[model samples]
Target: MHIELSRNSSVKLYLQIAKTLADRIQSGLLPQGTKLPSVRHLSSLLSVSPVTVSKAYAELESIHLVVCTQGKGCYVAEPSVSLHREEALDLSWQMSLIDYLPRAQLWRNFNHSRQVPYSFHIAAVQPELLPTREIINDTRRLSSEDPDAMAVYGTFEGDVELREVCAVHLSERGIRTEAEHLLVTSGAQQGIDLVARTFVGPGDVVYMEAPTYTGAIDVFTSRGAKVVMIPMDEQGMRMDILTRLRDTHPPKLIYTIPTFHNPTGITLTTVRRMQLLDLAQSYHCLIVEDDPFSDLYYKTKPPLPIKAHDLSGHVIYIKSFSKTVAPGCRIACVVATGSVLDRLVAAKSTTDLGSPLLTQKALLPFIRHRLDNHLVSLRDQMQDRLTTALHTLQRFAPAEVTWQAPEGGLNIWIKLPPAVDIAELGRLADREGISFLPGGVCYAGGMESNHIRISFSYTAKDTLEAGLRKLCRLLGELLDRSVIMERRPIL
Candidate 1:
């Protein structure tokens, strides 16, 4: 019987109180013919005027939602004869509509197989490099010394100091952005969601890099937009196809991860970057550049982000501190050049007032004290693991199993022989002690059956070797079974 009322809401106070009680009755929490509290008692409990409670009860009785007798206190009605079956049917239909509105696809089939022990998730954030001790100390300091900052709701555009620090970091990467152009969000996922909600809508054409980040695909597709998949090669998205497509079907937005792309682990070439910018400028399509792994370069020098070449104010750049700093901290920023920033701000304001201010404040110390040095250390450590993983994979894998060594990034894209089925192989690997992402999840139309993405980021040297060996063994078994099945006479 807890009724929390908001004084600021547009709904009348009495109606709000009535609705709360009606909801309890409808939900069966208040059984049929249950006695409700007296007006004075409810008023005192809710800290509201008795007149308001009296009006609410009168309205409920008038609607036959509750019955009031001469002597007995107001009791929940056992559905009066006036209530129609069609009304209940209509309510059920409305509830079904809300339930099936295609919200965030938070649950997936892969999560159900957690019963298998030794499950290695290739798409997880690397935990070994997370700044745990530093973040814990900063959290303690912020909670104790700056209690007011944590207690109050943050600004719609997030903390100004954090935006200033993010602006400086972007400047170093050749993206000329200011604090005003930046908007902090819960994570890069929320940043992408805000961008999608603000710009594209139903029937809008949104161009996505083929085999792009599955999470982005889910967000855009769930919004009822027509997702047009642009093909990608080793250097990244095929610009020629995109240019032709842009000429024919103008897209509302072009989403890409130009630097150290996920799954493929390929950086976009300078020529393609310039072409993309030109296409975006010529056609009126917005470009969303998701650059989360740009700072984790191992062998080659990091290339400038797509934002650096954007002479026009069409590209929206997004970056996350989750991968570089700590995932639990969940801090990300989006920089849009023109009116896109305003729309994103409005959408974000409605979603949440702002990201956690204390988390933003804690990150200031990392940017000031030891961000560069931490990246350097991480690079060195990852380089060692990458080299070891490459050598071990090469030694254990069969000749038919081919992969390219990415100059930088956390994972490797492996192309198995045509006859092998990676989806089935993933299940078989799950039964064993190893796991990897099937390539079908990355593609748009459920293609690419013989490909897999293997991450060597959080995996230790011994585990990396052991996992590769186990995977190769499974591949061999699959190939042998395929050969045997092919050789057998057809029934």
Candidate 2:
């Protein structure tokens, strides 16, 4: 129902109104048979005359985009196109096909084809920051040493040597685990999907932080699990609210990104980490701790993952190297204990037999020898980019615009005034060769449109600064126009 109209435009008012409604209808934003607001209601909403609204509705009816009922309001019309003889096969039966998996908004946003000159939507370290040559050398060594072994299928649980190396790597973060307790996954996303497949089911309750990782949301929802979002503050997911929600809808699992959380870039405090584990243990629910950005901290290390304190085998820790290292390699591991670990292995076997052994072996040498220095270099470079982003935002952004300075993580979440039209701002940004993540797509329940997430680690510092400046200028223009519209006299 949120619509933007320009009174100063050359387009006719009624035609503009019809076009907006037509766009929404065609895009499935306004589904078929949806009842539109009454002419009076829409007129009041748009601050236009009822006659203008009527003309818009009539325009839509003439084009067969909407069907008017005798007493009821206008409704979106179903497709009435006549099929040509060459393509006359009736495929309408496919319309009734089951949609076990609803739309994944994040995937749609990320996979968009429009190439922007300055993109901040990707949440990964810059390619230049990754250890490329060393990885290539490692792959070459592995292929040369054992081409036959690399070509063969690995054990369902994954390469023992890679898992062993990962175990040692995790020990530095205070998570005590052996190679046998880990299950190698294609990536952190695969780890999440495996866990959801192994446990979550239709109508099962899954708790998540609002504005959490979009991939996690899609994974859980695909399993038909009821994803309930817990609101977050600077400290992370509000524990008090979580406790209350658990009493009402006991969850099968709780998903969290404790360190350098995606979208928001907030880390959960140590106390909360322990508190979350305790609640999970008490409630007899498992916690899926996704830790992709934990190693990318700007200064001090983040609190040890919830798995560190998980004495009762309640935490399933997923560690990803895709973002920090070469994303093309796509190597990550899932750490769980007992039955949970067994189930994940079983599920992974059915998923892909095992992750590509070649990639795992290719990444092994880098992890054993060069990982620490590589991470340190990445942290420093990301920190510099973060500083540049903050400086540019301060210099160009309006006073009304605000954001929290995250200590770590690739993204900075910015809040715009509620009155400003984010869709319009996005359109303008796209035209200016800029792109960012709109906040509404991050949520599971309450759709928030006044916030946006931009990554500092993707673009070069100078390009990042320039893109952010352009974004801020476009936002300022939208804000100014919104004020003018609000003060415009009622027609």
Candidate 3:
């Protein structure tokens, strides 16, 4: 009954435990109907929290390897029953037969059900925050003036006028690029996917910020690229470690969320932005700069993007309008030069022909005329919300917990005591109609289980304080439980 768990491994603790037990069961070492250790007993034996053991057992049950009774311990399922269950699902065989899917650890956990009244999980701008009237008027005008233009197919590269607008948009961000160099995408997500598809290949080396956007992790891994995570500090992704890792594993690309980073909400300093571009150029690799929150700044604007300083075309810049303008439009653009831009256009053509012409046209007027004023108002509102969230957290959060107040971005990253089990906290929070993003999914491989990300956006203003208070209470309760567990003598 010896089970080993490695804290340093990229795979999660629960998943590792479940996989080991599953292997044992499949190999006939753990026979069918064999009663497994109780959750508490196994937790003590493995030096882990009961919640971790519970999650492992639950995973085992999900794949039909084990079963648990209300009061009894988990037991391995019968071979025949397991076989029948596997046979019931057609795609189950495909998983073993072909290596087609990526290890999407993030989506498996944070599915964004939105079933809860107090959801701090979603990272998009709420409808009330968007310029709905302005966009509607623009759409109406486009329909009235040129009905046939909206109906016809746009070039796979994107609408020329929309590209022109995006070029102007990039110029404001300090990136100098023309319409010909821009590739309009369905969204920033699609832009990331296109980059992955074009440049990444099996076993190729890709580097990223340790806790980056979840979608980037999924996309690169799906392309069979080995993702090496570089840790970050207050300033942003650690440059020294990246320098060290580059000697042994020179990357094909470095994916970054430089400004107002996702999950953590930390911005890379101007010095590091230049350093990053330099490193990418030295390594002869490309940098995919994802800038989703640069415009939503609370204080002074963030430094110019990494792409802005790229004199050698080492950076591919992606800007999304989903958060700032209209989410339903799903509009974003990629700025690249030479062959890289050509390959991205080729990838986009294969993916969806092109992003919808109507949406692009509908958004063009807004981006041209109203985007600046809209962002100013949006930033003001977001800053107010951030203030309220921070005050609530400071008042109710446990003394042991620590978090850095982000200057801008939708999320607030909170670090709890290591002893507090995140699995149990999530279960409790979900039961209480609360949802937040677990920190595990943000990493490329290794995980930090004691951290959680809560977005200040997309929650109703009235319930925001209550949700923060409830979450803080839960953290306190878990810490107390961990103390009690530590004091108990081993039987």
Candidate 4:
């Protein structure tokens, strides 16, 4: 086998060697059970040390890619048929169906390529702004001083100090919850999963906003709950639709992002908030209020969370430090009252013993002191980016496209002409080294083909400009093709 080495490559030499050999094997260049050349012989051929070859072979053997008989040399292992292929493939298809089925019928007539990266991803938090150095220092300090804390299993409700800190922080937003009322989760994603597991079950009807957070939709659908989407306008979820659904369906849970909703960055007005609470109370439905991006409001102070207005024990408020602090830290808090908190705690205990104690401790000081200052800085940065993004879009984008300037969230929702296929545009952008999430992924029934959400949080200013240019170019090509196909003369 001929092997080449790059001295400047970031991957370890042995790993590179192993991967090259593995690829060759997978491609059938090396037949199954074929004996590999001796390490010393291979080392001589490649001009690498014997130890490097040995380590590579050892790794292959450990992974069952290769095997060595006690007295014989190393040989490629016989290809093992996956025992779980049928089950695994079935599960994968099932999950895909859960995601795509609701909207599959609508998509069937569309022939657009699904391979593209839709140029706008509205759901992701800005990882570049995360306080990495502070978290690392705090983690090191906590591990050095309190090794025992790291070793033991955390309490079922999660770290007490973290919960207390969350309580104090959330109290400012009008949620009067004690530490016991809060449960620390891996992140808000897990919080949603736990809430679904605790409250919803097979065939349970759950109410969510149209053009809602896609992640929440997946969680609820995966749990076998029937989702009912209430339409949303500029002021947020239409209270009338929610009320009608609540009265007719009698949903088990109402999931909504009242402050700066996901796809459309609309905030729920105070009157609408009260109306939702009233409907939930009258219907006896549990409300799962997800407010992950409420902290980054650009224009004005956001209203207090819906939970703050919950005089009745209907709202289960879930928020995350991931958006404002760090994504990898995976720290989120869920505040619920009475029996709801109790059941969620029990559900959480089953998922993992608890969330990482070190992460919880590292975040305590940051939440107490650094978070407020961080939000102010983040708000300023986001405002500047949002302004720049809107100007660029207005200048370069076609006149047919329109979007809403969100008050404080990381992304803006753009409405493209109906004929412009976003999935096809996304595939074209992917070839140019740009990635974006399609609007179809954000809707419950796969609707939103005419819309896409653009995020200014992750992409830098220069990259954003370049990406937008490329995106517009792709959109123009798609429109031309669409128009040509529509007007084609038939024989």
Top of the candidates by lDDT: 2
The global Cα lDDT (0 to 1) of model 3 is 0.85
For model 2 the TM-score comes to: 0.83
What is the number of backbone collisions in each predicted candidate, taken in the order shown?
0, 0, 2, 5
Q: Where does model 3 exceed 4 Å of error? A: 1-99, 109-113, 489-491
List, residue by residue over 1-491, the lDDT tens digit for candidate 2.
64556586577899878866774564355557666888987899889999999999999999888998778878788633332321467553443343343535555667635567788888878788788888888778878989975668999998999999999999888999999999999999999999999999877899999888877887886676778899999999999999898888898999999998888999999999989998998989999999989888887988888999988899999999999997988899999999989999999988999999899989998899989998888889999999999999999998899999998989999998987777778788888999888887787633556889998888888899889899989988888888899899998
TM-score each candidate. Answer: 0.78, 0.83, 0.83, 0.76
lDDT of 1 by residue, 34-114 (tens): 668888878987899999998999988887768888677788887543335545544322321212123222234235346
Span of 10 residues, lowest total lDDT, candidate 3: 91-100
Model 1: per-residue Cα lDDT at residue 454? 83
Q: Native-vs-model 4 lDDT?
A: 0.77
Model 2 pairs in collision:
none
lDDT of 4 by residue, 370-409 (tens): 9988888988988887888888888888888888888988
Model 1 is weakest, by summed lDDT over 10 consecutive residues, at 95-104
Off by over 4 Å in 2: 1-93, 112-114
Better of 2 and 3 by lDDT: 2
Q: For candidate 3, lDDT tens digit of each residue in 212-322?
A: 888788788677677899999999999999999898888899999999999899999999988888889888999999999999899898999888888888899999998
In Å, residue 301's CA in model 2 sits off its true spot by: 1.3
Q: 43 in model 3: Cα distance from truth in Å?
A: 31
Ranking by TM-score: 2, 3, 1, 4
